[model samples]
Target: MNEIGGWRLSKKLGSGGNGIVRLAQKGEQKGAMKILRYDSPKARNRFHDEVMSMRLCADIPGVLPVLESQVDPDEPGQKWFVMGLVKLLTDQLSDRSGLRTVVQAFAAYAETLAAMHQLKVSHRDIKPDNLFFYDGGWAVGDFGLATFQGKKAVTGGGRKIGPIYYLAPEMLNDPGNADERCADVFSLAKSLWVIATGQHYPLPGSYDLDHSAFRIGSYLSGERGVIELDRLIASATAFEPSRRPSMKLVGEELRAWLAPNVEISMPTNIDFKEHIAAIEQWQHSRARAAKSQKVRDEAIRSLTNRLSDYLNSPLSNLKNLIEKSLGITTTINKNPKCGFLELRVEVPADQDRLAFIILILDLNCESFPAVNLQGRIILEWRNKAGFINLIWKRCYEFIENGADEPIKIDTLRAEMTEATLKALSETLSLIIPSHKIEHKPKLVRIKVHDEKGDMLSGVSLRFIDSEGITLAAAKTANGIVEVALPTLKNVVIFVAHGSFNSTVVTLPDENLLVVLNGDPRSRSMICGGSWVSLAGLKGELAFVHDEIEGGIHRLYVHLKELSGNSGAPGAVDLSIGKPVRLKDNAGRVAYMTPRAVIGDNYLIDFEHAGDL
Candidate 1:
């Protein structure tokens, strides 16, 4: 039996610690598929979480969609997920200076992180590889390592589970007690540093060092580039959890730095890292696109063979003999053998010459099951003498029951040759009238000439209109029509001729939508994370980074709002010129002297700083 689903697997794309990816397709839909190594509890749980988180963030432009997710009932330990295929940036971190591109790629990620934090959630792990781009936008992916703040992780056992290179100093010192949200900020900062510098953070073995020691040594040593970012990383990755800024603040700070220097022409919507990781995540989606293309190619080849056979047939000349004596033009129209069989013959100005014909062949063609043996078409024209005749024979089989063997090479070559002969013979039977035929104006025109090749005039067209309403429409002398639209937004046009329809759509603005007309498998984008604090403020500026069993952490104070003049309960318009430190979620302290000028409009409300 033939395969019910139209697909053929192509090749393997990639594999990783969790699963292997392959290219695949269903009908015309091409994408990638990921099959897990085993559906262990950990795998299944992670898979479930990934699907859920991806679905929640589906509106984010760069993130690929999860087409389907299935678990093997029998194996119980086998699972699979389908994802959109994307092109990947090859090892950009170790190679080129793509900081501008990197920022563009992670713009969407920043928005996502900010939104997530607003909802009181923490990704827990943020790194370069977990970001991806799709349709020119960025998204944060790999929620497998994510831990929602204020609550115990969905999966128990507090191991230092994130990538070591992006780990915060606090997580390195004591993994178990490290605050999830604060640690996420440090990791995000580390990622930014890598993208900006194309190198790892200052401390190479920081993940293995004591948190307290690494923080003091790395920050004071000044190994990382750009003094400002180095200091920001140091404060965000401080050994003490209380010293780290919130993810929201980190996003703000990163935006502040990038906004003034907007030299990046990239879309602020896509993530490129996620695209790379997705290639590492799912390979099946790629296979699907290949399979769909193969089917279409095969079908087209079959039609071409049939046409060639009719054109080369020896009996083709008989069609011309009948049309000349009748003093009329004959045109034969028939459906190809692919779908359904239809034959229509039109003779201008002669009722007897017109024919609506259908032909059926009883012979069993064993190879082509898609062809219908019971249906075929033939059109013939004859004069009063009836001795000399014009005949056109065309075959279209809509239903065929035959052997399911692959078509033989010899048979195809022979049939194709015969089809070519028949097509030529039939074309000669049609006689053009003295008047030329025009189909439309300023679009597509169907023209005709007489036996002497003299162009005919006063010929009108019968075709479909813009609304698909068929009518006797005429063309201008230039053979064109002005078909305007209701509005500029409706820039797309679709033309349908009988059974087939061709559509043309105008490209929308970049922010609106992107059409994937070609293979999406070879396309991809980079991914990155967002910062919480723009100016590196931590400790007292806390607004419930996450909920813990006992209480909240990443605490800070709003010094500007607290009235220090008379030691009374009052509020002050928080400013950013002087450095401020939030201490123990209980009070605020001066980190820098009043003489240190940062900027104005920096709201460090002593009472309302932790409003988040």
Candidate 2:
């Protein structure tokens, strides 16, 4: 242990070329003390400047507050200062916290930098090591290399400051004439990049000032996710200082990106308590409610536009696959009514028959409790052939607890939109029937190909005449199907094998080739699709399709044991969409229906039936 002035230094925290930081204690209070190692006039002057800068910006939101400053009275040369002990941002990262935490930390850091710039102070060393977490927010520490606006460089000439990897190109090229503010901006952007994607800036060891911008742009263009953030970083790191925005502007932009609800300004001094109170007051106010409602409405509108764009874009590969694999053109009709978004999907089955699926997405915020919004997605579709209706309803909750500032209600809206799309895709998969046909007799030669244009063999083909009678059924051995003509007229063809299915009508002489794309194995199976048998259970288990009371089809399961030696009665457990455990008292499991059904089912085979 060492003693500096009246403070007892119990442990060393860190050390650098200029100073060493130690965990210090004064009686029962704990803090951190940084002591200068060198005793020269220049070192004393720089230390005194840091002390003054910390004192000036102590009240700023993100700047670390100084606790005590002391000079050696006996030596008349040694100097040291104490600051509030804080957890380093690196430590927070080592905990493997979520990306949302990282984003909030960076947002607070940017706010602090903006506040410092407003007071003409530049934190020359703005890196991860200099950032700390104090009182549930991030604060900037280590002011050893800080500079004030309009001040001359303390290091005489041609000496660069800050970490090498984060130093702006201008600083590296012309150290003697570098702008401290511009370098601070560039370093801040680099810090943000590191926080967002657990990686350092890609452009390192490339000091060519003229081509640095191109390298940065090219690197960012290849990156995915967080699209808006990438654009901001590219603009902030422009090679020319004049092209980069001010720190205040950068902070504002970052706040918007992180959470649109948070509004921060460069006040002379920020009071955390007052700021929190303001947020709480705004959260319950009529104005805030209106704003939140507006955000939800905007999110709904944006979702509609995105869906439309997806339907029309060339990259709508899912749409193309669905159309080509099902042999049906689907159309979406958007209907907005009473704070609910309704989308109706129309699929034509034949000249006289059609199917409709309706999806109702309710995003009303006022219907839920205060400080939270409940989003409900109701999916219902009716198949004309069986007059069967399948309905699924899922609800999601979005919370806005006033402390969730910088995280907007619009984010909740986006989440709701994503959930609705996923549910719609799942419902469509279950309702779409396998291939069926009704057409006049004809003679035709047809070929089939996979999405890659490769010929597909082992495809099963079924042809039906206009009188709803199967004319021919065969499996292609070499991706080709030929049939003799009853007449050169229209014929309905159903092509299927495994999970693939398609229905089409064509003349006998037309050159026909069908292309299959989507993997039907990925689609969820509905109730009446197929039944499967399982072996090696306590009894013989099988899944059968059954129509329930409300015109809903479901998978019914039954188990029976025959010619088995009498053993102690037990229970057989089975899980499909839900869990079911049947007693073996009667040597059989009665027929039962599950709560919900989705996806494929599998059964394991074992040597002994009781092994299950």
Candidate 3:
């Protein structure tokens, strides 16, 4: 057994040219103890700088946190430091966790590295062993060769620091002129390559070791793995530092790959149970006083035909007016209870497509009694290069008649036609040359999953603008959907699969992973089957039945969080069912059952089925 300072070394972790690491223990706390091997001034200074760098990034979530440091009192020159001990990446790989876990771990690692770069420090060594699973997530360690931006080099020129397999070409060819941050990016990309493909390095004859160009495109272009991860690694490992994306961009890309769901909370003043009860009462009253089925069917058919004729005839004139004025071509299509118009505008000189205008008008007679008219107008445009772009969009709701006044379809149609023309004219004026715009199209990747973390294929994702206009829609291919929009404007994403309560997500600028509740095997099964109001709680608890595994039906209990000065609920003692628990990346307790108590274990009994 070896001992350094007050830490007792149990086993040798690893050794390198600069120092040796050992599993160290002090009282009950365990950590990694690194002992410097060289007594030279350069080596001593490098060790001191490493400690300083760690201290600088101590607050960052995923960067390894330093515990203690000291100079060997007896030797007067030797130095050592202790850091939080964590499981090796090899341990995770050995356990054979899913590919999603691997991607999530690397994504956290990238975010931590990017945070360090934001502080102007670069970790020159980013390889597999240096990354460890700490607090249930990945963290970066080993800053021995770390460099600070705008600071003089600590080591002499011509001495490359990282291993050859992971070294950036510039580090070998022109060490003096190489950008330390870019070199770190290159090394991280290589690390990701290893994680993605389980290979030591790029394929043996992929590219010359001396050449700066990286020829791992073939590996990156593979059909397996996440597409966004492939693109990010490719860009990070570009031949030139200028060509590589910034660490911030790398962090964003990684986060997009691990895409978490967009969180939605009920409004503060809304009581879900009370709202549902009110709606039920109103429905009962309406059902008691409704007309005969035959009479209702006849009325519905008449209204449908009237709406179809109005859109075909009156709306056509409005479409022609827009085309003649804007010098574009238009198409009209009928929707279930609405009408859709698409107008395409082209540049006169080049004949290249310039813009697209879409309009959706609600034609349901049922809604006319409450709100006379509702519609939306959207404008999408692209540069000379044909890409999807959005220039302007707006939703309109107008009441042409109050309870005292009867509704008139002709009057409503004429008024909407004028409003449509005005909106189109205003939109075209704001369409500037694409080259002059500063913001690029934002890429949004959506992955749909079930409660058990299994990906759902063929799910439909619809992108709706702020004004409730459907901009674009796509079905998931292999549980993933990727779309590019011209702007990072606020939008809502509506996800639908056979009858799983359609989930609505307010789209963020970043990518997303949407977890929905329905089981495809049973189309009639309602998500969160039914809500049971808790005795002393402000909100209800509902159980969503998941798949049956190992002869046990797994159910997720969702607890809606309380609002305002509502007191916290008591420990929910469910004697009827067994409770399940989950963990987050940091090993902190997280509840799969929404709004449940954190850090507390659960016990549930389901002996008496169908009884709350």
TM-score leaderboard ranking = 3, 2, 1
The C-alpha local distance difference test score for the whole of candidate 3 amounts to: 0.55
My TM-score estimates for the predictions, one after another, are 0.37, 0.40, 0.41
- Say what the RMSD of model 1 is: 32.2
The number of the candidate with the highest lDDT is: 3
Give the winner by lDDT: 1 or 2: 2
Candidate 3, residues 1-612: lDDT per residue as tens digits? 477777899888888777888999999999989888888766777777788888888999888888999742334745999989888786767535645677677778878888887676788888887888887778898888787743322667778777677888788766766667778887887887776666666532222212223322233322222333544565567676755655655665555545554557866765454344334334433532454676556655655555556556866777677668766677677662224333333322223434555555544333222122335443433323211222122223221121111224455556656656664554444343223333567788888888889888878766655333456778888788899866645454556665342444532545788886643221111122466532222354565433233322232455545221122332232211112232222222221212111011111111110011
User: Across residues 354-431, which tens digit of lDDT does each residue of candidate 2 receive?
Assistant: 444444444433322112222333332222222222233334332222222124344544554565456545444434
How high is the lDDT of residue 608 in model 2?
19
lDDT, model 1, position 552: 15
Stretches of model 3 off by over 4 angstroms after superposition:
71-77, 149-153, 204-225, 260-612
Looking at candidate 3, the ten consecutive residues that score lowest on lDDT are: 603-612
Q: Which stretches of candidate 1 lie over 4 Å from their true place?
A: 1-9, 60-64, 71-78, 88-98, 149-158, 172-177, 200-202, 205-225, 261-612
**Which scores better on TM-score, 1 or 3?**
3
Ranking by lDDT: 3, 2, 1
RMSD in Å for model 3:
29.4
